[model samples]
Target: MSKFDDLPEARRRGLEKMEEVYGFDMSDGEGDFFRYTADHLFGDIWQRPGLSDRDRRLLLIGLLAGQGAADVLGIQVPAAHANGELDDDALREIVVFLSHYAGWPNGARLNSIVEETIAKARRS
Candidate 1:
């Protein structure tokens, strides 16, 4: 079996999805960061065995929005949609809900990224 076969189901799915969503190529120059993302984030942490990927995606959106990480949102928002982890209404609700806790500015930035990513996804 491949190393990928050794990964837990959630981690394997998350890893494949991350590559598809982020266009991550571990062979690229950013090997260290990609490796950590693969080994720690997806391989270990995402395998914790409780919430589903949809639940995790929701939390990730909240964290990214709260931290003003719109750029990362550019990737994650569409990925959530593509993978069936989020729908349009759920995405909108997330923005509205997080606006209070994350602040309007961060929410606005995330909202913009969400729209742009959704549009891009539709076009392609």
Candidate 2:
């Protein structure tokens, strides 16, 4: 009965992948942005076989951090941890490594987000 039930196979797979990656039901999302996110980003890109989800997540973390995308990182960092893709130590190391290339300010922001995400997980 989900909206994705009637979608094309690729779209359905994409939505399912989004749920798996984000660890939540995403079938209620709507609109073009949602469609592209599920269908293209998740379906076509994330589904590609060249890299594991963990690999992709690591690359994405660097890209997002370099772009100073704290809001998106807020979602991605926790999801990465919850999915067992990145542990607290690995996350902390990324902050140190990317600081040189992505700039100290962006690295500082990443550090904050990483610590907050780890602390929240510990409290749960």
Candidate 3:
């Protein structure tokens, strides 16, 4: 059976987008949480109802910025791109949103990650 056979349509769409467009091959390259991220974060958890993919991306921006996770923000940035929830202007808007709670310093860090990720995604 296909991994998606019983899954919700949103999750199936998310998995396909990750594989075909974003080109992430899920694996335990970093061990532990990285593997958990690929499997649970994207695979299982995000499939839950109530929150749309757009809201997921927005929450990602908030949680990442709140935690000062600049490095992972690059990874999450591409997720919105893959899911069609983001564009250049939308990314800027996300940083603006984060600035309210996460502060300018956090927003700047998140923006730096977004910029780097945007450039890399455009290139590759």
Candidate 4:
């Protein structure tokens, strides 16, 4: 079956938000990775019934921050914003809140990345 076959609604929204923020194009050569992300990450994981999308985004922010995954976090920040999962204040607060557990350097770096992402989003 195709990756999209029986795709859950939450997964579809997640992919749409990812594309909107990251300029993702499934037609691009990175089909395998994209399909894995869509089929497994979003389709299965995001479809789990407990958390709301906002809750998922908040958890993602913390996890990405702790992992020092600034590049991915950069993409996620805007995606959360576009999805109405996070606002500017909430984004800044996440940096502050995560700084204690994720370390100052990671938080500082993410703060800068988040600012840049927000600026770019506004420009477009």
Candidate 5:
């Protein structure tokens, strides 16, 4: 019924980290969308027909850059790093990649977040 049900505990732990550390607040939803997304989006969907985790990470980084979601980028950049989704160079690549579509300011902001995230992750 939910992807969480089938997900490995490690990945589920990642989900919990995202929710707790990032304040995802899944409880606000009425449907099982949270579980569904966790399972499907992060678990099955990610493992199935969608792009590779690295690509998804790239997509997320780029999308976040486009929206100038510096906060989410700050969080996800480290999470994405923890998951081995992108190396520092690769992460930088995504931020650079975004400059073409999103503009310099958004890319600049995301670059700052990425740098801070990488630094913090290195400490932890």
Candidate 6:
């Protein structure tokens, strides 16, 4: 059977939200990390109504940049663009603005990832 076949409502919702946010199916994910990700992070935190998805994306982008989390940002940046939460110009502006606060080095890394992702998106 599939991992998600009999999941609780919250986890099920979380998986669906994960797919929506990341622009890919997450139903195949397994293990403790994936469970918590779906059950808490996506299910509870992401489901909060106070922030729009765009607002959350912006916050997450800044946090990820500040943390120098290029790998996660590699996923988030493209998903944000694909989900209409951020366009090319907005993504570029984020790199430019965050570079000041997040530090030039992290900003440089973000710039590279954003540029590469945008280019790849355009070519597809």
Best by TM-score: 6
lDDT of 4: 0.74
Q: What's each prediction's TM-score? A: 0.75, 0.91, 0.66, 0.73, 0.65, 0.92
lDDT of 3 at 20: 41
Cα miss at 92, model 4 (Å)?
0.6
TM-score (C-alpha) between model 1 and the true structure: 0.75
Query: How well is each residue in 29-102 modelled by candidate 1, as lDDT tens digits?
Result: 23677667765676666667898877788888899999999878887888788777787778888888999999
Residue 92 local lDDT, model 5: 83
Candidate 2: stretches off by over 4 Å: 1-3
Q: What does the lDDT come to for candidate 6?
A: 0.91
Q: Each prediction's Cα lDDT score?
A: 0.74, 0.91, 0.71, 0.74, 0.68, 0.91
lDDT of 6 at 39: 90
Order by TM-score, highest first? 6, 2, 1, 4, 3, 5
- lDDT per residue (tens digit) for residues 59-118 in model 4: 888999999998888778877876667887888888899999999999998899778767
lDDT digits (tens) for residues 1-124 of candidate 3: 5465565554554555456434465322356765455456666677679987788778777998998887778777876776678887888788888888898999999888777767877898
Root mean square deviation (Cα) for candidate 6: 2.4
Range of the 10 consecutive residues with the lowest summed lDDT in candidate 1: 21-30
| Candidate 5 lDDT tens digits, 1-124 | 4344455764564464445333444322234766566645554555555566567667777788888888778777877776766778887887788877999999899888778877877888
Model 3: lDDT equals 0.71
Model 6 segments beyond 4 Å from truth?
A: 1-5
For candidate 3, the TM-score is 0.66
